[model samples]
Target chain A: MRRQNLALVMTTVAAHGPLSRAAIAGRTGLTRAAVSSLVEELNTAGLLTELGSLPSGRAGRPGRALALSERGPAGLGLEVGVGHLGACVVDLRGEVRGWLRVAADNRNRPADEVLAELATVSRRAVTEAEGTGLRPVAAVLAVPGLVGEAPGTVATAPNLGWRDVAASGLCAQGLPLEVENEANLGALAELWHGTGTSDFIHVSAAEGIGAALVVGGRLFRGARGFAGELGHVPLCPDGPVCACGARGCLEQYAGEEAVLRQAGLAAGEDAVRRLASRAREGDRCALAALERAGEALGTALAGAVNLVDPEAVVLGGAYAELGDWLLPGMRRELTARALRRWPPKALLVSGLGRRGPLLGAGMAAIRRIIEDPAELTVSRSRR
Target chain B: MRRQNLALVMTTVAAHGPLSRAAIAGRTGLTRAAVSSLVEELNTAGLLTELGSLPSGRAGRPGRALALSERGPAGLGLEVGVGHLGACVVDLRGEVRGWLRVAADNRNRPADEVLAELATVSRRAVTEAEGTGLRPVAAVLAVPGLVGEAPGTVATAPNLGWRDVAASGLCAQGLPLEVENEANLGALAELWHGTGTSDFIHVSAAEGIGAALVVGGRLFRGARGFAGELGHVPLCPDGPVCACGARGCLEQYAGEEAVLRQAGLAAGEDAVRRLASRAREGDRCALAALERAGEALGTALAGAVNLVDPEAVVLGGAYAELGDWLLPGMRRELTARALRRWPPKALLVSGLGRRGPLLGAGMAAIRRIIEDPAELTVSRSRR
Candidate 1:
């Protein structure tokens, strides 16, 4: 009970930022006494600190402002995307301390080569963060593919043309790594940091359209850790064949390659930016392509909405940058397809931008420590 | 802790009935002594009964057979379908004591008239069960409609031509009844009584295609109560218009009326049975209609499967009755559309037949009592 209270208090402060004990008690439904004790325990453990005093807003003396400490346990996050490999380290306060990203067409690259390069980058991130005396508590890798239920295996990465790759120990040292899909991590970033809304769908459109579900503030990884395969969800049924041997999938219409092709731009790193610029300049073809892509995405998402009935559909990745051009068509189909009267603002663009996955991976690692602070202390003793 | 343990023991027995204390302990990971104590408490509370002794195959001593009691704390269930109104009462042991169903075309009928008639039937069923000396613990109404997030309102029932109807108090007397969608109840029933699998989609097709999701043995109600609107999931975006104002919805291709019309049969209650017999007799038109309907249903379900990633798809209601004709097509599309290597036997037919909803509704009510037996005992003392 005490452990749970401590974790709850830490996460509450982490998510909501600096809060008075009374505010935390109100937020967590814990008594003020319990919150105070938990806050004191966390402070003693170096996971939290008091930021002098802040006005209570109520007619009373100022309350102590509690915040996550910059010292102690930190999280190391690594990502292997279709076109980039990135790494970052986040402190207990959820602030990024060190970060690195290298753009490379990873689709045709050998898995070992890319992972090894990623490992070097991840080591540098860890060492760089360590320079500030931060100890690594957890390490997580985000890959753009379907992760198997069992540990250490990337089942398939259609865009990367890789399957059954063992992905557990990509770092310089064996750090009990957790491998999750990039989109899932991105959604987690939004869930823990951006909106903090419990039930939403984060749809990330890149080379592929990947969606992740957040139900009750937790990433809803389904039966085999394959819950959110929105890209392959059939839209037109007979429209076009996909790499997964399926036809009329959402990716065929709204994915980066498809949208780029429709816009008469070569599918490359800057295609989305170019499409956005072209559309901004009132280019009819670019506008038409984006509109068509948005319509297709919205049509498929409408079906998804009818089935899942989420609070909101958060557009992420390249879609986040292009949501302004896409949302009009997307909202039309979603409104037409919804069985319930949607709230005036049901579709939202992710505020995390493209850095969401790396940040989420870091948060996920930090969350593991928060969920079990005893593990953090034990690791600290070992270090 | 004791209360949670008691509920766990009861639910374990309820899900996998007729277990010895040792078996229950093993299944629940509770110590034999703890199980024995919990069993004694439940038996003393009249919630459980021991049936002498049953021989243990590999054990030295014969273990006493423990089961849920067959008396007290009965659940009252009422269902409003597009073509039928039904009521049932089930006891502590999940045994039905009374059931009644009246077929009526409810689409054109006024909400008050239909609900009033339903109330009459429910009162009679409750009175009939009372004669057997069973006390009502909880009452649940299962409506074939989109129930809103806030309780007691049917947002829409496109098939029944109803919308925005306040449906909280339905029976003659004021019973603070809980209203749930029929499909959600059906899924709960399967989750509790069928295979007891944690994650699966229950697809019940009759006048419309209704689906419910069960994750970790609990109903996955989405952001709102309007989750699992499988009927409205667009399959062929431009195929045909749906009653929900969407084009090419699953209902247009696989709904009862659509299938019957395609089979050259007048759409009515008997059409499903007639189609089944005709298909059994090698009638090409009927076979073609069923095949098309199954394929369309599968195509949409495939998209659903891709998004939700359930362990299995359990066909219920009319679909179960017509599984032989539907399985091949449904399986083909589902298997073809899956991103993962799905288990060979991922499709299942409900064994409870059409009795699933009534059973589920009753079980749901009983579950409320089981969750808080203190309430049941308190109500009993008051009575």
Candidate 2:
């Protein structure tokens, strides 16, 4: 019972905090005395701090405000993308304290080698956070593949030539670790930081297209954790075959490689950037290729919308960089094909871009501490 | 608190009865005395009955078993199909007491005229149920289109030429009425009475194809209650124009009319039955047409499965009658196109066939009384 009350207080403050004890009690339906007791424990653990007093509304002495502490246990986030590696730290306030990114060709490389490099990057990020008085408590790593139900196991990352690899124990050595799918993390980021809708589809792209569904404020993983494989939804039943042995999947038209190939550009680390620039400069081939890709994306999304009926569709990852060129064709197809009256405001471009997965990883770790502060508090008392 | 306990006892008995009072207390985490009190009230209200005593394993006397009363208030179900109108009464134990079906060409007919005829049928069903010692308390009408968020207004039924029609007040006089979409009700019936999987997709077809998603035992109504218009999902994006003004929708290839046309048969009330008999007799044209329709249905379902990842797909309504002819092409396309490994057991045919919608409607109304017997008890006490 105490643990549940503690969580209620902590989450209330995290969501609508910098509040007085009376305000916290009012919002959470707890008595003022109970709020004060929880606040004291949180303050002692460095999970909360007192701020300036609020002006009295009731002609009495003013009450001091309380907020989530900035110097508390923080989260360390790491990412293993196909083309890059990243690490960062986020505080309870959902603010990044340190960030690092490095270009690397991780595809098909030995898993140990890539994780070893990530550990080094994570150590640097932890040290950077420590310099600011933030204690790094836990870590989460996001990867572009299917994650097993068991924590820290990557069932299959086809692009990385990995199958059934254990990932958590090798990185962020001292902290407890969890692994998550990059697309799921990206959708969580959109829910917690971007559009803030409890129900939406987050579509992202890098080496291949991926999507994650958010339903009622939680990720909607299917029965086997294989929902949201939007990339493989057939666009044409008899068109050219795909690597997954499907014919004319949406990925064959809208994935990063597909767009570049259609634009007659060589595949490289900077190819998407070049294509974006070319389209911006009124190059006919680049413009046409992006428009067609957008149409194909819309066609697939129309099917998704007809089936799932999410409140919004967010364009994230590489797609965010090409939103202006993509939205027109997408809107046209959705308007014409979607069974529901397509709302113009339902399509949104993610502001987090390539940073969403790493940031979401950090936020996810921090969220655990906020939800169950008793774990940290119990350990602290033991120490 | 008393009302809640009463409902808990009723639903517990409905699900796992005929159980003893000791068993109810064990399953509900309530004291035996509390269970006895709730059961007394339920029995007094004619909502539960004491059955034969269970065989005792202990040294003490055996306890009488409890079950939902068959003589209590019942539900009236009504359906407005393009080619038929139906009415039935179901008792608290989910047994149908009375049923009536009449062929009616309701297409583009005046709403009042069709509803007036339906009221006559519902009256007969209610009278028949009452003769069997059951009182019909509520009714639910199932329609083949979008129902508004408001209780009884239908937003649209394109085939019925209905838009913004207030339906609840028009039919089943003197009984409280509710409105629901036929596809949604079919999925609910599958959950409560058929496959019983908490997560699956129910696909039904008549004039047009419809699909409903069940997530965690509840209907996943999208942002606008328009989530399952599978007929409009593009099958061949550029093949043929549809009445919905979209090109190559699934309806153009797999709907009842479409299959009849492909088989060189005339469109009429008995068209689907004729097609089925022909396919059974090894007629090439009917067999070929059914195969093609199955492929189109599979193509659309593969996209749905890729996006939602349901545990199973149930073929319902008219499609269930033709399952033997449809399963082959469906399995082939799903194996070829769906990203996840396809399991043959995931495809099922509804044994309820065309009766799912009406049964589901009656079950829904009965569920409301089962969930909250307080309303009935309180009214009875007043009398």
Candidate 3:
């Protein structure tokens, strides 16, 4: 309980730094005595330390300012997709310290091999941070499939041929680990830190179109933990067969691979970017392809709103850089299709951009550790 | 505050029978002195009466008993559909004492005509209950469309051809009034007293498919209040044109009109029931029609579960009478389409039958009055 209260205070301070003890008490609604006790405890534990005294003009006593220790535990975040991996190191205070990216051919590789490559890329990112005063106490890995809450089992990731692959093993090499679909993490990031919207939809325009929904500041995993498979929401029953054995899934139209396949371009991020840039430069064919993708995505999103009715939609992932062309059509189709009584909810590109999933993953890891302190034993002991 | 507290205590007693003063104190978490004072207040107010002492053989002092007065403020519930109106009178404790059903043709009628007919039927029901020692002090009206939260206005009711009808006026001539879409009310009824599932999806299958979602024991109105418009979720892009100017909405496949139209029967409830009876008797045409409707409905439900992740789905309204024939195919289709990771949630036929909407409306009214005391002005004034 003490640790939890201390952690809560530390996180509050980390989120809103260098706050006077009175301010921390006001923000957390804790008694001044409780705040002072927790602050002293955290300072003793090296998780928090006093910065200075605040000069209170009308107070009987001046308040001491406290801040999160720069040397406290950090978290590592990894996002693994079909043929790419992204890694980021985040401090305990939720700030990104460093990042790394690598391209790997995971098309036909075994699950363990792909995981090994991801781990290698992650290790390199952590090592590259040299003396940056940030050390990871936990790590979260984001995948592109339905992840069971049991900590690292992928229920399915069609593009990667992962069926119940044990994800805990992938990032559990002597560290705290968690895994979730990348889109869900992105949604979480946007909900908590990006736009501060409590309820919003997040779409990841990667190899496959995926979505994450944050409802009331929590992920709404469906009856199963696989709720946000936005890619598979049937768009057209007869259009094209999807890996999920459905046809006309929104992903089949708007995913990076789908867009490239439709545009007859090579299967690469640069290829997707080139087509988007060409469209931006008034290339009719490229514009048409993105326009088509945008329409499908927008229609699918409107269907989503008709169901969940979130306050906003945050776009992210590899194709996020496509920007206005995608958003305008999405906005248009949503306004046209959503229930006419309510005005269309806002549509905004993800503020976290490519870093969302990783940051979200770190947040998830920290959440898990905080929720189950026994699980934090090794991480805390490492301090 | 004392009156409100007394009312809550009396309602609790009515819900759970005569309770000892100590038991009431324990249940309401009020002090024994407070419970006694409130019980005396309610007794004086003619809302509650003292019962014989509880026979606590081992107790040092037997506690006096209290119960809700059978003659306390009662409530009226009405469900207005295109072709018929159903009404029920319930005690403040939600026990239905009398019910009435009348056939009327309201399709294409102006709002005034519909209100007049509704008034005729409601007055007749109340007149029939005059000698029963119960008079409704409040009324809840359930319409068959999107009822906007704006006071008095029903945004749309396609079946009745009534847009923005002032429902408050319809029921406010002689009593306090509240109105809601039939589907939303059905959900409230299920949430309040149905088999006690904490979280579930309620689908009202009548002229069109509507859904009401209960999560964490409360309704989840999407960003806009139009969260449960599952009827409009596109099922087929090139299928039959929907009334909403869309093609292949689930409603076009599963609505009452759709089933009757497909069976080559007139678009009437009797025709639909006849088709269902024949389907139960293994008539090929009826079975085929039901199967098609079931498949479309099931697909839309799968999408809904993938979004809201409710624990169960309760079918209510007119089409709910289709019985087991329509359920098997729906279950089969949902099982096949929903992500295999989460096992299918349970499906239930509404126990409230056609009165689901009526009871749900009553529950909603009671909840509104309880949570927002300002809505209870008339009831408090009567006290």
Candidate 4:
């Protein structure tokens, strides 16, 4: 609870401004003493630095300035996808200090092998980040699959052929770690660093479709942390048998693999890239597949928009690449079906792009330190 | 800010119970001085009563037995439906002190006429509640329509033939009031008064299907308070044209009118009651209609469950009467569609029955008292 309030104060500052102590008190509704005490604690933890003076309140007195420090309690992010692996570190100010990404076919690989490779890349990123004076306090691993309830175990990543993959085995030193679905992480990235709406839906795609809900500044993880599986939401219950055995799931139409296969290309990044190029070049078959995929995704997304009424729907991951081809159909369906409301703006492309999940992973990794100044204090003491 | 903390303290006491001042300090993380101050304030407001003593922790000293008082602030609830009008008053302890219900065909009636009749009934209930020594501090009116962002205004009620009607104009005397959709009130009732889990979807149907989401012990109002219009969520993009001009909205198949038409009966409460009675008696046509409605409802609910992943899906309103016939198909679809995990319990029936929304309305009316005891103090002063 202490950390929650402190974290709120820090995040408010990070999101809003380097406010004066009085402004912090007003914004956070903390008594001046409480704000001063928390600010002092944060300063001691190297999470904040006091700047000289800024324009003050109505009294016109000079007020002390404060800001997130650049080189303390950094967050580490790692992501595993079918065709790539990524690692990054971000400072308290949310600036990327170090980053690494690699292309690799991870599908059909043994879970242990892929995890080991991810760990090796993660350590290398850590070493690089440390050189720039950033310290990783925690880690969040993003996977293109279902991350289970248990800390770092992935229940399944169908595209990666993974099951019960305890990824934290790589960082067995009890480094606070969590495995999260990539789409959720992507949404988190958008919430933390992109367009500043607290209530919105983030849609991302890879081999399968994924959507994440950000309501009231927090990810809307459902009763089982399985809240946002937009891919499986039935658009046409009796249309076609899906991999989940339910018929007419949204994934059958818009997933990257589905789109590629429909476009008469093999499954993989190469196929996706070629499909994009062909569509851009006005090839008939490729354009048709993308167009149809857009319609299906749009129709399903319209239903989602109608139900949740988020401020906007952000396209991320591979879907970000196909926005131009998808937005027209997506907009048409949403305009017709989204409850005739002015709000929940028309579809918006994710500003964070494909690197969203990796960036979001880093943000998650450092959340504890930001939320609990005490955690940062302890981290500082240990260092 | 002051009242919010006061409300939190009062709610904490109301929820947990009779803790020592030191214990309150520990539980709320407020200083002992702050807790003592808040306790004194609540005691002055007639909201808290200290009874003798209870055994304490640590030092084993006797602690005052604190509890919510019965005769302090009360909530009055009123509801307007196509075929019914209901009102009730609940004390601080959430016990119903007085109630009144009437059956009427309110369709196409002027909003002013319906609201005036509702006010007359509300006054009667208020008089009855006063006779029982309960003062109505606030009221919540439940309408079968969309509650607009403005206080006590219904933006639309297609069934009631009302639009942009500000019903609060009737209660201009300023006993704090709000207008809410009946389905939303039902879900809140289930959360506050029934066997409780914070994350569940409460589905109820009248002329149209409505679903309300309860997450973390609070209603999820979405970006614009329109989060729970499940009736319009497209289940089949091409199945049938719906009143909203969308195709295959859940309402087209599972709404009361839809089911009655399918069951070869006139559309009304009598027909619904007869359909239930006949289905119970193994009447073939009635049974078949229920089966098809359940499947259609199930398919759409499956999509909702897949999107929200709530702990349970509760049936209320008229659906409670039809649950016996609808559960099988609903459960089957949910089981097949939900993530392959241990979550989202099978379909549940509302124990609160048709009265859930009214009860919930009462609770909402009094939420201010529970949330901010300062308001109670202010009310008492004005009196």
Model 3 C-alpha lDDT per residue in residues B175-282, reported as the tens digit of each score:
777777788888888888786886778887767777878877878887667778888777775578778876667788888778777877787646657886788788
lDDT of 2 by residue, B262-337 (tens): 9999876668889999999999999999999999998888988888899988999878999999999998888888
Q: Which pairs of residues collide in model 3?
A: A152-A167, A309-B223
DockQ of each: 0.70, 0.73, 0.49, 0.59
lDDT of 2 by residue, A242-353 (tens): 8789898889989888889999998666677899899999999999999999999988888888888888899998788999999898888888988888888998899998
Tens digits of per-residue lDDT, candidate 3, A346-377, equal: 77777677667778887776555444433344
Candidate 3's DockQ: 0.49
State interface RMSD in Å for all models.
0.8, 1.1, 2.1, 1.2
Q: Which residue segments of model 1 deviate by more than 4 Å?
A: A1-67, A123-128, A148-153, A167-169, A379-383, B1-68, B123-131, B135-137, B148-155, B164-176, B379-383
Docking tier of model 3: it is: acceptable
* Model 3: lDDT to the true structure: 0.73
Ranking by TM-score: 2, 3, 4, 1
Model 2: what TM-score? 0.95
Clash list (residue pairs), candidate 4? A7-A371
Better of 1 and 3 by lDDT: 1
Show where candidate 4 strays beyond 4 Å. A1-73, A123-137, A169-176, A342-345, A372-383, B1-13, B16-73, B169-172, B342-345, B379-383
Candidate 1 vs candidate 2: the DockQ winner is: 2
Instruction: Choose the strongest candidate by DockQ.
Output: 2
For candidate 2, what is the DockQ-based docking class?
medium
lDDT measured at residue A297 in model 1 versus the true structure, 0 to 100: 87
RMSD (CA, Å), each prediction: 4.8, 2.4, 3.6, 4.0
> Which order, best to worst by DockQ?
2, 1, 4, 3
DockQ of candidate 2 (2 decimals) = 0.73
